[model samples]
Target: MRELYVKSLPLQDVIANLAEAFETTYFISCHEYRINVPEGYGSGFIRGINFSSGFGLIEYSCTFKESIKIHFSVNKIHPLKFIYCSEGIIKHRFEEKDSLHLIDQFQNVVVASTAQNGHILLFPSGQKIHMNSLEIARKDFKTKIDCDLHYVDKNLRKLFRDLNARNLFYYHGNYSLAMSECIDEIKNNTLLGFTRRLFLEGKANEILSLQINDFEDDQKAEPKRQILRKVEMTQIQKAAQILKSELANPLTIKDLATRVGTNPTKLQEGFRFTFGATVNNYLNKLRLEYARDQLMIGDLNISEIATNIGINNKSYFSRLFKSTYHLNPKDFSKQISKNVLLEKL
Candidate 1:
């Protein structure tokens, strides 16, 4: 096993420590530090950035030839960490503990160590792991935020308000679809320079908000059934793909649920939680969006375009289109044609 000790903070030092352990160089661009895996270590890169708001982000996307352990052992109070595993599995344990907590794909955890107790991350050999950590220097963060946190969820207020590092806290749960989307945006965004920093800070805060909201909702749920699970999210993703592909052949919620290997009630809840819309409502929205694209392309008549998107009735499609876009389908198509002609001239 290869052991790496990272006694650093504020993201930049963390990256520097890792780069030194691997004996490779790192680069900083737009306030983000990134290091590519050297020839001997495996493939992929690790990058991180820190914002002035006392929040930072670190991303690990790599595979190792041998099992690796990263030990974070700063002398001062450790920052609060919100960790998400998007691919493969990541095992984490407090520096003083022996047992480990597994964070699988689509799962997240909020962790705060009491005092200076650090964190240990384990990455198994040959596993391609993708994980993101959002760290907040609590003492610094509390000072920047408004003093009144009464609006914060009761359960989270203590977690967020504990600036003295007096308590240890940990909560593990599945990532909400909204949070997952935000993570994707943060990872894949291509904005540059000042805009990139602004975008990342905004997304980091958005993700933190969503994580807090999910934690609150999870706490409020009955113990018998946590509102969302990783498996259910997978099923919902499958169902969404089915809806998009099989639009012409609509199915009842029950049938769709069965096809996706989940129950109707859970399916409904999943759709509502993930997309903020009922199943039919989501389908209708998808259909309308597709119809608008076809209309703009001017490849099919209104009836054909409607049918293509699973609406068989031309008049009904026109009403739905008008309701959504404030323009009838035919008129919208005409406008597209007129714009194309004018552009050509």
Candidate 2:
């Protein structure tokens, strides 16, 4: 019932040390690199790419029977770190900081630290850990040959400047579905050989691009409403899951709001803030995307596909599909067919 701080290391050394400290084996190939700690005594897996271009990724999931504290150092070369935790609690504090800051599940933090090399990470025992780290080497990024970070946030661009300002900065917020999905695709990618290396590099850049672009979009789109309480945000997100799952019968925003015990205005505002889209827009995009997938793979005609996605009127469905993709359902299916035939040829 008491708290504890467990272990710490240089930020870059975490993966190597984890492999050495635990009985895990660190395996590498042209495709990917991973360390697997077999079941019993904090079982987990850390798998990602260590690209030569100075950018790196680490995807980790573990469950420890005891609390853990990971103290780490960051040098000036790669002073900024963007970290996302898909699940579990992540507590971090800099050396000069008076207190710890929490990065909750599905949230991320962009860290810009002073040249000082002292930071600590804390995770409670008995809680599962799921995390993804996208480490950017500022030195590498500052050069055009190594990488281009033009679209990254201004705070990140500061790392490239030759200045004496090395103050600590941490930008924390929720990770969008686009970013979460991109990470999943990176982890699940099955290509091999040189193609895998290219894929890794591409996906790594994509991770940065998605985070940067999505955060900027949110800043512009988010409404200036009073902050919702923790319970309200949780309720709003839960309401979103309901909308996603119950697509067969759409619910009015007012009805959805009522179901989650909130008024329509707060529900709509909270939904946009939490998910980065209005309730109606999110649902519309979700339905259309699902229908597009079905068109490519399912053995159904355009009308059937329309009916399958809960649209009783086929013409209305076609219009919606065309508006979203610039092609009606049937034409979209035919284009996919044409591409498949070309591949076979």
Candidate 3:
């Protein structure tokens, strides 16, 4: 096992420390510092970016060759941290504590240690870890012009107001689909320079909002009323995979739900939340997408394409395809053929 210590404040210093520790090069553009892991240590990169608003984002996407522990210790009060694990597992514990909290995929934790207690993160060997940390310097954040946090939940409001770090705070819950989508956008964004900075700042706040909401929703006593849990999401994704694989002979909603270990009502709710469509509608959309691919290939006629995608009614399939892509299937296929011929000529 290897240990790395980072004693720094703000993102830039942290990244510099990490680059030194990893013996790798880091690039900086518009205040964002990014470093790729060196050959001997691991694969992937670590990034840290901060905004004038006192909010910072650090992304750790890596697979270490050996177990590694990164300790974050600052001389002053540590910044509030909201940590989310999107892949693999990460173990976290306050500097002064002994027990470990495992943040599994789709799980998030909000932590604020007392005074300058600091934090420790453990990354297991050979596991792909993708985690994000949203840090806030409470004193700096409070001084911002738009720092009003009255709308926040009562407990969180208190946590936000605690600039002196008088109390230790920690909350754990499964993040929402909304939060997951925001993470995806943050990870996959292609914007550059100043525009990228603006985008990241906005996304940081958006993710903070989602994290707060997800935590509050998890506090509800009624499990049924609470937002979806990570386990529930697993079931939902399993159902979606089944839907895609068994399109030609898809199971009924109840049967599918049973197969995926969830109830039908919950399954429907999951579909609406994750895919923004009813199961039937989502299935039809998949069929249409598959039909479009077949149409482009040109080997299958409209009727065969429709049948292959599980829609036996050629007329209904044609109408659905047209409604989705703005052209009839037959006409779309002809257009593809015409384009190909023109290219050949």
Q: Pick the candidate with the highest TM-score.
A: 3
- Clashing pairs in model 3, backbone N/Cα/C closer than 3 A: none
Total clashes for model 3? 0
Of the two candidates 2 and 3, the one with more favorable TM-score, higher being better, is 3
Candidate 2, residue 145: how far the Cα is off, in Å = 8.4
List pairs with backbone clashes in candidate 2. 6-69, 8-71, 9-71
* Candidate 3 residue lDDT tens string, 14-59: 9999888888779998889999998799899999899976889999
> With candidate 1 superimposed using the best TM-score fit, by how many Å does residue 259's alpha carbon deviate from the native?
11
- Each candidate's root-mean-square deviation in Å? 7.5, 11.3, 6.6
Error of 3 at 180 (Å): 0.8
- Candidate 1 wrong stretches, greater than 4 Å: 222-231, 237-278, 281-345
What is candidate 2's lDDT per residue for 1-345, written digit by digit as tens?
223221323333555666665656677677466777555556777776666645777777877767666655434333356788877887888755768889888788877656644566676777888888876555554564325555566655665452333666677777765677676777578888789879878877887877776556545533432334333577787788887788778788878977887667668768676767889888888789889888889587777766656789888888988999999888898899999999999
Per-residue alpha-carbon lDDT of candidate 1 for residues 191-265, written as tens digits (9 for 90 to 100) = 888899899889988988888777877765343233455546889989999999988887889899889876776
lDDT of each: 0.85, 0.69, 0.87
Query: Residue 42: error of model 1 in Å?
Result: 0.9
